[model samples]
Target: MNLIKVKGKSENSFDYIHEKWIFKEIKESNEQKFKCKSYKSKFKCPAILQKISDEYKGDDSLHNHPHPVIRTRMEPVNKMKVPKTTRKITASKRITIKPTVPEKLKEFKNLVTAYQLIKSTFIAQVEADDGSCASILSTKYCFDLLGKAEEIYLHATYKIQLSDIKISQILIFFVRRNNIGIPCVFVLSDSTIKSLYAKIWENLILRIPSIKENLKRVVTDCYLPLTFAILEALPQTDVKGCWMNYIRMAARQWKSCNLVNMRHEVLKWSFLIPSLPPDQFKNAIMEINETIRDKKETYIEPVTEKFMSFIKRWWEPAATIISFSNSTNDSINISEYFDRHMGSEFGSLTPDIFQFSECIKRICDNSENTWKMMERGAQFELYEKQSFIKINNHISNNLELLSDGKISLEEYFKQAMTSDIHELILKILETRQYKNDVGRLDEFHKN
Candidate 1:
């Protein structure tokens, strides 16, 4: 055994010892003595002999001993192993947790009431602070508050019989799912051109900066100028022509071409083309073309050419016709709703350009806020019911297994431990609470 020399001024100092080895420090007079801390343990520790003195006159290398003396103070002389005991746990009766209906109802009611109170308070604060509490908020202001829109629906309400002059109003509705936010309106004295529409859209984007990246889809009623303008402005955005509008346009074209009997059939064919897969769409188009060719009437040539042109221009390259078709009914509903509200508010008098624009803006703001409130309530109700249903169904299944003697209590508990219903419940609660907080803050700032 070779003796290891460690240089240190104090016993507690660990400068010279290897980190892997364990040792104990002992104070003895002026010099310190180091004993192997692991002398009697499982882990191996380096053996260190007595400390060398500077007064030793012999050769230091010869004085160093190979075999190290075990330090008696560091040895575990009274160590003993204790006996271990095992435990057996018997299965207990299953405890069924009944859903507390009244408590849950109370909780939901409290949450909704709190949400409404916060919303109302915040809106009141905003109105009070502004001092100019007008019925109509600016379209740009509403869009800024609502944040970015995923889809933009454009329509022009033309020939509005106003008090002084007849003007065309271009309405641009920002949409996300079934909810429609504030609509930007442009009153045009003359027919709208691509350049004019492009400029309006450019200005609109400047006001709502997020629209540039968030605007993924643009749906319009097949106006060539607007379609071309949007394409030029938003090159990456997918432009879709409304399916209902396309069919209506096709019907008019067919009637104009004197194909009265075939008009309905042609419209049906056009409607079916958008729903077909790419390969099937091509086959259907070919079949339609063949059917049109069979018509011997001299005027049928123009009708066929027009139908083919529509398919190539709009139907074939469309991202989705279903979304536009779905939104068509919604658009009509919104228009009717707006008309009813406007009628009630203004009665028989036709508003002037400024009044008309403000009326539209006011209606849009009220509708948007109303829709948002309804949507939040509906979402909370839906998530709560879904969570309970899932949890109850799982519990019922586990109870059935337990009653059938197929699973032990331990096994059932193991499975129950795996169920993440608590996480879902907590998440739903947190989400609703967070929505209320953020929504109230947004409303408070009039955003």
Candidate 2:
């Protein structure tokens, strides 16, 4: 007899054949059942007996389970039994994965790399000896690179852009005021109000950790929006108007009112205000009021009144906090640097937004480097002075020797000429003269 395995209808059930009988495991019954063509039953049907014993009867009952059908056993047939089989199981494949950096960290690294590249490029251009090369570098190529760098850096660091809706470029400046070095900037945007400025500042503070404690005062052009914004964001910090802008605005107002003669007076007043102590500010205002009262008959009366109103409104309130004696020269310095290195063509032509940003950044970097060099020059100046004093003493001693007849005039003159101090003094004078000429050049460019 051959036993054949057949698939079960359900997962747990299977079928096998033994000669003329077929047996199936009934999942619901939890027992094997058999069906045979010979209804008379050859052997005491082991499948049925097993099912009865397992499902309905006990072990002692099975010994007495020779019912009428099983008592009439005809014969028993011997068949080979097969062992149980199962589906083969295989091991799953292993997967290999490479490590990676977090997205934000990677982005920050990229931004830093881009910033260095942009800064290096600008420094190179600024240092270039060829006028045409420097000009070309600043015009379009450098501008575009700087724009890209700003985009990358600002987005990575602050998640903000200067090109965002209604936003112009952000003007940043670092200034030392009242023993406090504050790094502050203005975000120029469309129709800025106090509330808008406050929101922008809040966002900036949230993103820039350095700004939280370092910012002490804000200096601006007395724009209403900017004034309100600073007041709202940092109520404790002092807000002062740019003295230069104040004077310029006053001059413009004087011209607009047809009181051109008063323009010089306005300029003089602007210069005087910064030098006065806070306590004297009120006295100065009173004096101005008296002057206006005396000139009430002149055509300048209305203009003078307007100017006084401006002073009372903007300047008086800020007198105590105002530390800068002159209007900030940052903008002037940047403009001069650009004009000097880039030429009139680049300066005159209005660059695209990106190009303009690039220009500003390059100017800032160059200005910073210039300031650093000047700081070092100051130290050099001290050393030069010390050397000058020593050399002067030696020269005086030589002169005394020549006068006393202890040394020949020729010998004294030769010793004096041979002294290293002569060369040192010449170098010092030349440097001072060069610096003065440069200052004049800067003033010329500014005008």
Candidate 3:
């Protein structure tokens, strides 16, 4: 699919042409051609119409419609948390400065930790031109080992090596789900079909021996060629989905869609079970599944007439928004990108923040900080002053439930160092607060 960037705004039409990902572009004043295509599709981008069709699918979660769900793994962080001082000492009385890490920072840390824990568990990072290169990820240390997702996972430049096979693989690891063989790694990407090499997977597996046996599912976005590659690499692994990337072509031209918001809660939880530990993880898993099942049992909610009109109000800007690649991957790029970029087209991360919270219970960062961000992005007048304060105090009172922001620092460590945590997982203990899957995890941990 092409996003042709045209200058002087001619017909104002958008269309995709051929296998190449062509986009129309126009030059700014005294600028050269704002060329949208790089001769042909680069190794990074996919083929033409396939990408376009997937992107246009109906993403109307609000109406409870069935749309493809987007999924991506965020990094994770460390433990020693700031406990709610048992004594009612004021902020001034506190000698040690307790930094309330923001939700963004917290999420960044979780992603870093997840990557490190997985890296250590998988040891798949490739060595770069520098011999000391620890991984394909441009990082010296996992971020949040210190603090902040950025600090824990240092961003680095990815200089492409022609000699190296560039295959991208999504590894899915799971703990015993009630001793069932439900756990599997769904390989989603490969070199031959989508330009991503399979050797990249080999290099990773060789680096981390533990992942050899435990690998279960390996799936990717609805990108066909990439999907085909996964089929080639590990025929056994269940190809789940990379729903977000594939939606471009799924349900375009529906006028508007509200499917994602309705199942946002479900999508949040179910997707997480694969990445967590046993029963405790299972507990959270079971809870969300139960909720979704219960919700499904009821009458499906349909979009109201008023909702459509409200949506059309903003339709004019929709094209401008999509053209900017605003909906692209962010759940992956927050800390991964250089200082210049924020990873996805949607620079506003409120949806993802809320989605992650609803899914995992708490981000590695404090619930308080996440709320602050929600307030700042109150463009829809969502975070009214009163609403903000209410959420803050509610989170403060139940900080333990807030993932890493427990009222008791000891509880946070107990949760982190408690039995069954792998070394790689613990490194990012601080970044993404490992929710005990609410009580479902407790049920497993208790038994």
Candidate 4:
């Protein structure tokens, strides 16, 4: 009878049971004696081998028992061995506040990363700031308060097409008192496709009694076409560009590969000096450009002068900001910092509604980041009902007159905007028909 050669710890031995009728004692070649006993044999017997990171690597386990049925072993050493379970990383550590996610309900947790919720996105809604007519609670932003409050970002998940009805619902919610009324400049982050997301914008415009033309400003990432779209939709609305955008655009289209050093320098120069004068800012850029052009031995082709010219040529609202803000700097560091912590929705320039909604909630509660996008007159849209438009318009027009179209905290404290914002929010929540994932999660937290 041919004895099978079993691969053991030393590769020089075989544990072969001689041809006994039944229950034969197994013997190995004297030259191939092995020490470790973690291995298993073919007839559902334990083989001698060392256990490794939840895996057994030996000749018998591979040659004798390599079947899916082996995965079903009860003794674990034989029959079948199932792979050990491991914890999966998520965008946020906790998926929901509810005891368990219901079968049919939508969950925002499905849209974001585990690390993202606590670290990247900030969820904000008005906790305070109720002071306006219309019994509306003056607008205040709310979100999670666990992390260090900073440049938290909002990224939408799938496309959240804002129907006019949805817009009216949201607008009615965002502004507390819709009675004082002026066209409000609703802001959104330009990190995603603007037009696709504009479905959210379409809703906001239709919510109010005012014409779309009255919507004054839209700040955005400074995409060329978006500027035209905003102008077309609301001629009075100025399409402001974020400086981060200009830098990103210039680097992509104008900067050559060899200018790695130049690119880094440009990024540094753009944001470090936010308060510089217009002429000084222009000169600073020119210097960077010249440095790139002159460095023949250590660099690639320099960026075109048009890079600087494009920025200098405009006096648009965010021009000054876009001129100095570097999307690659510490400011950008924070944005990216937030991005890194997020498990999903960071790399791409587009986001869905659920992602966007969570981000907006966070931004509203955080003070520094409030309407920071507005500085750029970016292509913006808010999700709300038409009643919201009436309320926001009341705030915007009146606030514009009261404080000259600029937002101020003190103004909000003076009066309530609509009815109680918290109450209205509850009403909106009721209409959501769907529950807020966080709200559901809160239920889980309590349980």
Candidate 5:
């Protein structure tokens, strides 16, 4: 195993990387001991190492997920520097600077800042110099204090981090704690990987045993890595693809493949695919591709090819769309709520790690009061558009009817393709509310 020194989650902390697995220094010990970083996630990995003098020992058990491809480097945060002593600043206002990091890692230079403001709170943040990675966690107090539920939502919010490098996204896991959707874990990383996601889920499960014991289903976007991650972490738990996210991606690709001319017919199919049973989903998509291919216009071949590639790449997640959960409206509402509050606190511009951490801290700090209010019968409902709920219900009913043999596949498809979501199809065709999937289709195709 190639052992590499890497920056840990906080200042003065260090991690050892051996064969893509990261090990953190065990604290409060006279001897040098390291434990697998996966222990920090929802997965309980039994890997450990002990260094004695110049030798290392201990059972380094296998990790559950693959080796992650993240490069951790210490960078400077010029904005977080201590203000000079000229103004009337209190002792609490003064910041303490840590020792300088080594110069060898100049390429991946960035300081990681951590703040421990509220005690007994289930939140902590480690902001890297470039705002590339951070973590907001719910400690053991989460279960002891807040309400519990059997479902969790893993939502990824993008374009919220402060970094010169293009950051992918931040993952936020939510649950209907106290009858309101509250984020239980927030993990931001430089890249999205199945292992990272698996660890985060493991961490959540470790902290809140109910997640593993009682979690029935998990609803998330159609990110295959995350879907697989959830299953890897909690195999018994049912993972469902977010129907809204699936349709949104389809809409984006519909525009990208230049299917606007065929939107009137294709839009109905796009809305109908998710409503179909898993066995029929593939055929429906293939049928749409055939429809596009049969258009007979030479200009349509490129579009057909694009759609075909998309079908191949999206097969896994799309196949899981009709499973457990029907919609991610609650998760979307919570995400928008977080974004609205963050925007209100930090303005329209993207917030640096510090500000980002601060906003999360505020949310965590106020959650206690929110829970208290909920206990007193103050209903804090996740606001969702009624139209979406109606459409989802209609589709769900159609599925149930189809499964019960009350309706044939043709009848189900007829209702799904034409009647149930006619408004959305009409809107897409008339208003042209279409855009590319941020080149995701092409990127996935190349990969």
Candidate 6:
């Protein structure tokens, strides 16, 4: 059998491609053996290859499928070279060098390699400067800022897109530096294609082992495409939905169902759904649906249907751990950061290519400065971190009370909306006491 060696899903393993049929190494096999790729399919293919001395043998006894067309897997193609920076070369003057296509590509590739070496990141793709598409540029800094971060945030800025330059969006990856979130990676894409995003993220995860191994969580908006892409690439990392996005989606659905009066309740449920224990989440959703149906409004059916549909799409199959549910205010902070810098500095919501480049440089410099500062032992008081921990602990404690049947779901919902959960807990106890006293007085009067 003629076998061609190809890269496997992992670094140590190898797959054999043979005349439209692929074979994967069988881990359980004692000998050097490979099973047909379709062995796990419903067809139950029984083809196998066993290594005999320096040669291999194939058995296609149960093979039934026709030959498949061979397609190349998406691999990182190094397209640019890191440019040699001299004392005379500065950030402003670096982009002015008009060079041949080959030279420009080489220079960019080298720069990307240098950036990857420093930033603890991997450059997935670098589009050539054909003037037809936007190119992703990388910087030359020396630090593993991303590796040290346990969580990262993903966001996109459309305000920097230049229509004339074919720049549709700029995707940014933010990692923490001394508790201060900073942009660790940037990708300038021609369009917001889901597959493109998935491919980029997949390549990044595959190329950088630290990010793949050590990254614990990622925060992103409730955009299904982006969320799915992140999960597809970083399967091990927890994907936390942005709080603002969660409220916006729930509110939008509420408006569509003509249930604006129930907006506060809907928002409260939106926060509560992902916070519930996984075993209780689906039932809670059902209970909420029944409660809405009990409202007896003319549009009650639509309200329940819309709410259920929203729950099915967004909340179902999502992890229900409260600590992983919301990204407190990272989304808003990043948006404000972009607005203050990109809006004021560029003086336009949409900047041209040159202005956008400068803005990216500014962002990179800010991130590098943050990394350096953190390395120098400069500390940033993370109010968000403190709040996150407090809120998580508070919710966990309340959830324990809920699970123990000590607090009713109604009271839980009400307290969930309160800013100070401890104060709400105290108020709940006071209300119960007052009601008990009133009941005793009424009973005594009746006697």
Give per-residue CA lDDT, model 6, range 1-447, as digits (tens). Answer: 567887666666777887657888888978988888877764356778888877787754345333434565544453123344642386646545422222222233334433323223324453323322234444545124556568777666555555334555666677754334567567767645556666666556555658877788887655565667788877898886554445444544555555545334544565566566667667767766766677647435765676677666656676453323243333232332433345665556666544544556655665675566556554433313443344656666677788789987766776665656434322432332121221111121221
**Candidate 2 lDDT by residue in tens digits, 173-235:** 334321111122213233233444455556555545445455655555435555666677767
Candidate 5 residues 1-447, lDDT tens each?
435787667888877886646888788778877888877764456678777667666553344433454677635564246454533354435444322332222212233332343123334333333433334444344443322657766677663555333446666666655324566555655556665565655655666676667778777766667778788888998776555566666665666766765445655566566656567766667766776677757445666667656755665464664533344343232343444344564444476544554555555545544555455544443323334444656677877888789986656767755554676544433421222244454443221
State the lDDT at 144 in candidate 1.
59
TM-scores of the candidates in the order shown: 0.45, 0.39, 0.22, 0.31, 0.56, 0.55
**TM-score of model 5 (CA atoms):** 0.56
Model 4 residue 34 lDDT score: 30
**Segments of candidate 2 deviating more than 4 angstroms:** 1-170, 175-191, 252-258, 262-267, 293-299, 322-349, 357-361, 364-447
Quality of model 1 by C-alpha lDDT: 0.42
Each model's lDDT comes to: 0.42, 0.38, 0.28, 0.31, 0.56, 0.55
The model with the greater lDDT, 1 or 6, is 6
TM-score: which candidate is best?
5
Candidate 4 lDDT over 1-447, as tens digits, reads: 332333332335434321211111235634333332213332233434333554433334211111211111134354244333322233233344313322221232332343343223422111112211010111222211102122222122112222211221222111111111111122322222334234334443444325343333333443443345445555655544323333333433323322334324333343322323333455555565666577645544434444444334443334444432222121121122222223342222243343444444333333223233223332122211333333434434433443443533223323323334324433432331222312211121221
Q: Determine the backbone clash count of candidate 2.
A: 0
- Ranked candidates, highest TM-score first: 5, 6, 1, 2, 4, 3
Native-referenced Cα lDDT, model 2:
0.38
By TM-score, is 2 or 6 better? 6
- Can you tell me which runs of candidate 3 are displaced by over 4 Å? 1-135, 138-195, 242-246, 252-447
Give residue 302's error in model 1 in angstroms: 6.7
